[model samples]
Target chain A: MKVGVLHSRIRRDEKLLLNELRERDHAVHKLDVRDRSFSIDQAGDQFATLELVVDRCLSSSRSRYLTAWCERHDIPVVNSATTAATCADKVRTSLALSEAGIPTPRTEVAFSIDAALDIMDDLGYPCVLKPVVGSWGRLMARIESRNMAESLLEHKATLGHYEHKVFYLQEYIETEGEDLRIVATDGVPIAGMRRSSDHWITNAARGAEVASIEVDSELETLVANVDAAVGGGLLGIDLMETQDGYTVHEVNHSVEFNALNSVAPIDVPSAVVDWLESICLETTAVSS
Target chain B: MTDEACIVCDATVALPADVELGEIVDCLTCGSELEVTGIDPYALEEAPELEEDWGE
Candidate 1:
């Protein structure tokens, strides 16, 4: 099958896929999205005769728009454009999860500082203040008091970016120094890891130690519900334990599995490529 | 004249005759990895940091 790789930089994740594709004897076309322009028609000769294109661009905006363009031209892209857009924005993901009755942290949004502070009141103190459009816990803060809330709001107001003022405050789930990062395809868990850290934020990128974990029945149910809510694709679902149960905080599009690869017993990248081949081959069989 | 000016300094760094996007070129003056973002006029941007972060 002819495979088109849409990427800006080749990280470990992409390198794994590229190597697997080569080993499998599939033709790989590396489409650097930075220099690729979208025409209303074919875009360019690079897109011709491609069976599947993977959206792996580093920038959310670029990946979303380019995938949309590909869809317009009747091309197939894994983790389609709609899924990318929904997963990229925190507010949209929240809405999708809430509407589907998925258990997520109690979250509130406000446009003004006063309204945000009022929301902080409803959620109570020690809640988290997070940027609406970031990952790996960048720019996320824990507001422990009303005074801190006021100061954060003031600081946020002075920022130039519009996203800064759109406050997304979430209830800080008190867990036992860990959270779950499960990599799954559609609704099925491929590999699961426990990110443990001394700090409140347990993201693997933030010096958290990673160890493999078992996928319990409860986790399976939650991820299945989450996959349905997010429209299904290769995704990373983040969950935190609460007094009630496990509440999913985020689902990432174009998820990274290199860290999970280290601890998981299963060959993570090979499994992913096998899944990718299955999907592409099945689709090609149908069309031809 | 297919060279692009180094983003670090105003010194010109010669680009390959068939420069493609995502190709990393080095700055002769400052020794920074420059990525080709454009080809028509040969534009370059500082290579993005490669640190793995929480998934996007």
Candidate 2:
């Protein structure tokens, strides 16, 4: 089997996957998106022979565009471009989850600062303002009052980036400083982890303490539903335990799992490779 | 093992035998983040800073 790992900087998560693939005697090609160029009608020789490409690009824009390019070249890539497109934008992810009847935090998008203020007024203070395209909990604020909202909105408006102008606001879910991250492929969960932190943002990159978690029947059902909603590939489904139950806050296409791997009972990288092998076999069979 | 100069401090930085490309290593003398750019002759360059869209 031949596998291509698309990445910019090789993080620990990518190293694990690459080691697993190499251990299985798979020909692993390291495709650095920054060093490579893609033509509309052609794929580089490095991409020509790989059976599958795993998108591990750190940049969301690069991931979205590179995956689409691979798809155009008829090369099978894990976490399809459709999934990438949907997960790349917070607004689109929220809409996809809502349209599928999946429980997600109440979210609204506003074009102007005034419109955003109006939505903020209705939702009241203590809501979350997130960048439409970002990860690791960066550029997210907990608006505690009208003054705070206005100050943040002014800064964002004047930042000059078109993305900053688009305000994505959501109701802040109280989770007691904890949340869940489940890694799945095609909707079936491989393993789960809990992120706990003193700060509001419980992202692993934010120094949240991580531990392995058990996926009960309810979470399993929701995971499957998320896969259906987001058009499965390799997905990281983030959920918060609410008074009602579990509510999905975000779905990540190119998810990192080094922390999860350290605590998970099963070898996460091995399980990931298992899924990749199965998909490769399926693709090969179809092509034959 | 390979020896290369730190792009930031020009100090000799030793790389591990299995160092992979784009692998980030901190310069012991200067504490600068250096990325492995080549394997044959062993080249090191300053790692780029993270961009806003760079995350999962």
Candidate 3:
């Protein structure tokens, strides 16, 4: 089998996958997105022979573009172009979850600062303001007061990027500084972890403490629904425990799992490669 | 093991016996994050700065 790991920097997560593939005697091609260019007419020699390519680019923009390019060249990519396109944007992910009748946070998007303020006024203070396209809790503001909201909005307005101008506001769930991150394949939960922190954001990237979680029947059901809502491959589904139950706040396409691997009872990367091998075999069979 | 010059400070830095490609190592002298772009020829480049759109 031939596998291409599409990445910018090889994080610990990518290294595990590469090592697993090598152990299985598969031809692993390290496709560096930083120093490569793609033509419309060709996938070029590096990408032409691979049976599968994993979208592991750190930059969301690069991941979206590279996956789309690979798709255009008829190369099979995990978390297909449609999945990557939808999951990369917060607005799109929210809509997909909402339309699918999945339990999610109440979210609103405002194009102008005044409109955002008005929406915030209605929702009251202590809501979250986020960049439409971001992760790791970057640029996420917990609006505790009107003054704080104004200051954050002003800074965003001055930042000058078009993404900053688009205000993504959501109802802040009182999870007591804890949340769930479940790594899943399609609709099936591979393993789960609880991210806890003193700050409001509980992302592992932000120094959150992680612990292994049991994938119960309820979690399984919710994740399956999320996979159906948004097209699935390898997905990181983030959920917040509300009074009602768990509400999905975000879904990540190119999900990272080094933190999970350390604590998980199962070998996270091996399970991932098992899924990848299945994908490669199916793709190969179809092409042959 | 390999000894390479820090791209920022020009100080001698000792790399580990087994450093993988794309692994980030910090220069002790200048504290700059350098990435291992090549292993065979032993190359180093300053890591790219974080962009707004860079995230998982």
Candidate 4:
């Protein structure tokens, strides 16, 4: 089977996964999405034949366009364009999760500046401010006061870009300085990790420490439900332990498996490759 | 100010720029409902602008 991995810089986690795929006799093609002239046909020619495309690139107009093209060509993508779009946008994810009856923090979205200002009154102060369509905890801020929230909202209004079209204000659920990252494939939870640090953010990119944890049956059920709700073949569910119980913080359709692998007992890369191979074989069978 | 069209609704009605975001305005021509897109062109210049500081 052949697979194409799209991203600008290949990180250690990605490298491990690629090496494992090669060892398993699966042709792995690494293509930088930034190459403006890069074509799927050209990249597919390098490999035996394109069976699936795994998008690892950050959210960008070009990356989004490429993923959409792959979907148009009937190429089985790990996380399709729709899932990526929903995952990339915090507001959309929150709304979808809410509709799915998945437990998540309360969120509100406003398109107009006046609406944003008024919405703040409803959400109250000390809420989190995040770009409606962002990831990796970038551009996420906690507005501790009304003045700060107003200033941030005004700034967002002036930008007039889609990224600033709306703001996501979630009721901050106080936690014990840690969160769980559960990785799943095809609605089956495979690995789990607990991230802890001094910072309020528990993102691996934010220098949080990660440790493997056993997946309890309840947690596995929650992870599976989230995976099914996301409809993404692979997903990363970030759950926050609150006083009430566990609430999903976010669902990452595109995740870097390396951090989770550091503490996980099983070889995640190999597992991911095995999953991809089965998907490829299934597609081949259906086509033929 | 009373003779000018609303910035969002295009109605022949005067309203302050700091009006509530949820206030709906009516189109005089089509009578269609319109809400503000939250942007105030007059305040555009006063907004804190940040140029892309790529690779400092």
TM-score order, best first, reads 2, 3, 1, 4
Alpha-carbon local distance difference test for all models: 0.84, 0.91, 0.89, 0.70
- Per-model TM-score versus the true fold: 0.85, 0.96, 0.95, 0.78
TM-score of chain B of 1: 0.79
Tens-digit per-residue lDDT, B1-56, candidate 3: 78999999999878877577887788999999899988988999998887888777
How many residue pairs of model 1 clash at the backbone?
A: 0
Winning model by DockQ: 2
Q: In terms of docking quality, how is candidate 3 classified?
A: medium
Candidate 1, A1-288: lDDT as tens digits: 798988886556777777778889999888877665778766566686898898888777777787798889878887888888888889999999999999999999999999999999989989999887778878889999999999989998896378888999998888867999999887889989999999888888788899999999999988988888887888899998787898989889878888899999898888877878888988888888
State which candidate, 1 or 3, has the greater TM-score.
3
Give me the runs in candidate 2 sitting further than 4 Å from their true place.
B1-5, B10-16, B28-30
What TM-score does candidate 1 reach?
Answer: 0.85
DockQ measured for candidate 3: 0.73
lDDT of 4 at A184: 86
Give the C-alpha miss distance for residue A223 in model 2, angstroms. 0.8
Residue lDDT tens for model 2, A94-113: 99999999999889999999
Estimate candidate 1's alpha-carbon lDDT, on a 0 to 1 scale: 0.84
lDDT of 4 by residue, A1-288 (tens): 778887644455566776788788877776666454656554344433678888876544444566777777677776778777667667777877888888988887777766766777777776787776555676777777778877888887786476676666777767757999988887788799999988777788779999999999878888877776766677888999877778998888767788898899998988888788888898889989
Better of 2 and 3 by DockQ: 2
Ranking of candidates on DockQ, top first: 2, 3, 1, 4
